[model samples]
Every structure is written in structure tokens, then in C-alpha cells.
Target: MRSGIVAIVGRPNVGKSSLLNALVGQKVSITAPKPQTTRHRIQGVLHGDNAQIVFVDTPGMHRAAKKALNKAMNDAASNSLHYVDLALFVIEAGRWTDEDEAVLERLKSVKSPVALVINKVDKFSDKNDLLPLMEKLAPLREWAFVMPLSALKGANVNVLAKQLMERMPEGPPLYPEGQVVGHDLSFTISEMVREKLMRSLAQELPYALTVETEAVEREGGLLKASAIIWVERDGQKKIVIGEDGAMLKRVGTAARRELEEMTGGKVFLKLWVRVKEGWTDDPKALSRFGYEGG
Candidate 1:
């Protein structure tokens, strides 16, 4: 069987997370339109008949300010390039920016062959409209294959998966069949809750928030879970809770419905917000929030 790690690296908001979700044919990673929406290396395992593709979806690489968490995120995205079997360098087909080109340059040091996955093709009227932009990126195109696909619409997604597999090294299966991802049901449930909160909250608010699964109990044909919504400030906590706790209720209810559907068990979602000043800057806090390194 052909199996290996395929790293998806790109700048923020270029549909990197969306592409991973599409490849797995499931909502493995949470997605939002905002930049830096993904802050961790989420692994989505794709098990086919003869192959197992372990897709490592990294956070968007960008220039960061003082915070160690910001630096860690950028470093994590770049470090993901090392030792991968293949690199899927995702980009926005509608527009090409210098920042995108800058990120592509870093991929040069990657040991694996890079494949360009041009996402959001549905935005264009036709392929012809993208030819000019494609021509501009043609120099790097020689080093990789260009795949025009829309992650949201699943257009040409199968084709992209087929091509990506062709580049993977032949080996034993990395993961068992019928397993869609490496993460467990509890971790995924928390991620979904975080995703909904991330999509709904303001940019600054989402950054400060982190979701943790406090408890999971299965009884009487149902699963009940308690989750905590963490924020860095009391005011941010108030906003997340909202007037009469409307916002928290919305996040909890949406998350519970998805849990019940995916897990086939009823859920009791509990949400509480606590203010932890400068959690992102604290090394201990970052590690607790799923970060690997210092």
C-alpha cells in the first residue's frame, strides 16, 4: 500500500484548511474565512482501497509580532515541510499576492516534491480567466503540478486526490481503513465547537478563545459532554457569553447537534468562559492548548 504524510502548507485564508476537509471527504478540520483560523497541525487520515494518506494541515504561515504563540504558529507551518513525502502548496486562484509567492519560496527547501493546489476555482467564470495569473506563476509551476479545484464545491477534488497519491511513496498503510482521522471523537467534537465559535466570533475574540472537552459520559444510548470556552479577558468572556448567554448558547447548541449526528449519541454541551490574562504568551498555556513546542 502507498502511504505517507502529505503536508498542506500555505498563507492564512488561502483555503488550506478547506482543502484538507475536501481531501478526507469529511469535515475533519474546522474552517473559517478569517486568516489564521487554524492554529494547530490537524491530521486528517484518508484511507483508500490501497493507500492511506495522512494529511497534516498546518496553520497559515505569516509574519508575526512579539507573541511566542504567533512565532510558534509560523514556525510550525514552515517546519511541517521537513521530511514530508509530498507537499501540497495551496493558493487562492482568484488572486496571487507577493505574500503567497514569498511562502512558495520557503517550500523550495522541502525535501518532498511540491504540488500546487489552486483553490476556489468556482470564483472565476471560466478557466480562461485564470490563465493570465497561472502564466505569472508558471516559473514555480515547472517544479510542481498545478491542480485547479474548489474545496467548498468539491469540483476536481477527486482529481487532486488521485494526483497527490501518485506522488506518495509506496509503503504499508499509515492508518487503519474506515478511520477518517487520527484524532478521536472527543477531540474532533471540541474542534467542531471551536470551529463554530471561531466562525461566529470577531477576529480578536476568536483568537483568544480555546475549547476543551471537560467530560464525556456515555449512558442510556446517549453521550453527554462538558466543554469550556476559554478567553483571555473578562470583557471578551462577557461578549462570548453575550447578553443572557445568547452567544454561548448558540455555539453550544450548534456543536451538540453536530456531535449527535456524527457520534450517533445525544449530547449535553456545557460552556463556561474564564479570563486567563495573556494565555497565548504563556508557554504553559500554549502547550495546554495543543501546541507541541516552545
Candidate 2:
């Protein structure tokens, strides 16, 4: 059987997480419209008929990684390129930025074959409009394969999967048949809470906040989990908690519903927002929050 690792690299908000989810037919990474929604190197396994593809979903690589958190995220994405069977360089169709150029320059050093995945093609009404962009990028490098598809609309996604499957080296499955995600239960639970907070809070709030699952246990038929939402300042904490604790309650409810659906069991989740005061820039705090390269 064909089995290998494929790293998805791209600039922030280019739909890299969406592409990984579409390829795996499940949500292995949380996605948001905001940049840097993904903060870790998450893996999703695709168990096909004759191949098993371990797709690594990485944080968006970008410039000006001044903070400890951003540096760690950039490191996580860049580190995934090494020793992989294939690398999928994902980008949004009809748009290219300086960050994309930066990622391409970084990919030049990657020994693994890199495939150009032009995602979000469904944004355009006419397919022919993509030709100019394709022609422009064709000479940049000798890419292994180039496929234009939409991760959100599922357009040409299967074709991309088939192409990736063809390139995987022959071997046994990397993960068990039914296992789709690489993270553990606590990580998954923490991410769910973070995702809810990311989607609900203000734009800058997400960068200053993170979720940590403190305790998880089974009480009869229910799964009980308690987590702390760490913020960098007292003002941020108030915003997260909201007036009379409305915001926190809303986030907890949304996260608990998703957790229940994911685990296929009832979930009782407790969330408490605490002030950590610039945790994003503190190495010790970053390490405590599970960020690598801290």
C-alpha cells in the first residue's frame, strides 16, 4: 500500500486547514477567517482503498514573526517540510503576496517533491481567468504536480487526493484504520475551546488568548472537562468573560456541543478565564501552553 507524509504549507488564511479537512473528510484542524487561526502542526490521516496519506496541517508561515508565539508557529510550519514524502504548497487562486513569495523561497530548500495546490478556485466565475496566474507561477520552480481546486466547495479535491495517493511511497498504513487525527483527547478539547473563542472574540483577542485543558474524567456516562482560558491582560479577560459572564457561557456552550459531537458522548465542560499578562511573548508561558520552540 502507498503510505507517506504530506505537509501543507501556505501563507496565513489561504485555506490550508480547510484543504486538510477536505482531503481527510473530517475536521482535524480548526479553521477561522482570521489569519494565524492555526497555531500548531496538526496531522490528519486519510485511509484510502490502497493508500494512507498522513497530511500534516501546519500554521501559516508569514513575515514579522516578532513574538515568541509567532516564531514558534513559523518554526512549526517550516519544520514539517523536512523528511516528508511530499509537500503540498497550498495557495489561494488569483492572489499572491509577499508572504507567498517567502514561503516559495523556503520551499526551494525542501528536498521532498512539492506540489502546487491552487485552492479556492470556486471564488472565480470563469475558469479561464486562472490561466494567467498559472502561467506566471509555472516557471518559478519545477513543481511535482499542480492542481487547482477549492477546499471549501470540494471542487477537484478528490482529484488532488488521487494525485497525492499516486505519489506516496509503498508501505503499510501509518496510523490505525479508524484513527483520523494525530492529537490526544486533551489537546482536542483545548483546541475546540480555543476555536470557539477565536470565532467569537475580537480580531486581536485571539492572539492574546489560548486554552488549556486542566482536567478530564469520566463520571458515569458523562465526560467532564475543565479548562482555563488564558489571556494576556485583565481587559482581555473581561472581554472574554463579558458582562455577567455571558461571553464565557456562550463559548463554553458552543465548545461543549462540538465536543459532544466529536466524542459521541455527553460532555460537561467548565471554562475559566484567567490573566497571564503577556503569555504570548513569554517563553516559559509559551512552553506551558504547549507551543514548541519556546
Determine the backbone clash count of candidate 1: 0
Query: Which stretches of model 2 miss by more than 4 angstroms?
Result: none
Model 2 score (lDDT): 0.94
lDDT per residue (tens digit) for residues 1-294 in model 1: 788898999889999888898899888888888888887788898877778799999988886637878877887888888878888888999787777877887877777788888899999987899888777777764455888899989999898788777777889987767877778777887788888888788867888877877888888987877878778898999999988989889988998898878777678778778878888888898888777586
- Error in Å for residue 255 of model 2: 0.8
Please estimate how well model 1 matches the true structure, expressed as its whole-model Cα lDDT. 0.83
Give residue 158's error in model 1 in angstroms: 0.6
Per-residue lDDT of 1-294 in model 2, one digit per residue for the tens? 999999999999999999999999998899998999999999999999999999999999989899999999999999999889999999999999999999999998999999999999999999999999999999999999899999999999999999989999999998999899999999999999999989999879999999999999999889999999999899999999999999999999999999899889999999999999889999999998899787
State the displacement of the C-alpha of residue 266, model 2, in Å, after optimal TM-score superposition. Answer: 0.9
What ranges in model 1 sit over 4 Å off? none
Task: Give lDDT per model, in order.
Answer: 0.83, 0.94
